[model samples]
Target: MSRGRGWAADDGSAVAEFVMVNGLLVILTLSVIQLGLVLFIRNTVVDAAAEGARFGALADNSATDGIARSVDLITTALGPGYATNVTASTGSYLGHPALTITVQTPLPLIGLIGLDNGLEVSGHAAIESLN
Candidate 1:
């Protein structure tokens, strides 16, 4: 008599493998998106710093003006409340008048724990003294 009949071998087990691969792909895609956002914020902040430094390098530059310009540039480049606690100072670099601008902003991220320090951006440029 024939033993207990059993079904033939099947390849249906690939479904689980496919699902796992797709899940990994999805996670990778999200990670890429997050990295892009971080890069964007970094570039935007750098540009703002450069702009502020340039403005502060002008002939009629002052500490307040530098800070204001930095704030405006950062706010415009990023968005409202993006730049906060900005400080600008004047110093000498290579025996030339230099202006330094520092700015801080918070990064936008989901559950960005332990980031209470936020982000900081700064720029320094030689001031063109119109004497």
Candidate 2:
């Protein structure tokens, strides 16, 4: 009768196993969510900057317009804090007069401070004329 080391002495391995597995799952889920947030923020900022540059490139617009538009877009989508470092300037794109809009914002990681310099993104559009 007998057959091996008897089906007994089942230590607390199941509990430890569950803990390890669940920990990994939780970490993985959080990482995925964080990545998604980063991507969404990047897209939103880039599009906002581009839209601002386009607006400023209109026949009757100035670099200030681009700055304002960018700030407004970012503030509306994320928060006013994210729009604090917006800037606009005149430039040339492909030999054509252009307006450039730059945006720098915090990339929230653990809390909301993120890196010391955060992330910076810019957009440019050729100036339009009504001649």
Q: What's the C-alpha lDDT at position 125 in model 1?
A: 88
Global Cα RMSD, each model:
3.8, 2.8
TM-score of 1: 0.79
Q: Residue by residue across 1-131, what tens digits does model 2's lDDT show?
A: 74555567566879999999999999999888888888888899999999999988898988888888888899999888788888888878789888889898888785455774488999999989888
Q: Write the per-residue lDDT of candidate 1 for residues 1-131, one digit (tens) a residue.
A: 54543575445658988999999999999878877877787788777777888887888766677777877877887676667677787887678778888877776564232253377877888888767
Residue pairs in clash, model 1:
none
Query: Could you say which candidate leads in TM-score?
Result: 2
Candidate 2 accuracy as TM-score:
0.87
Model 2 residue pairs with clashes = none
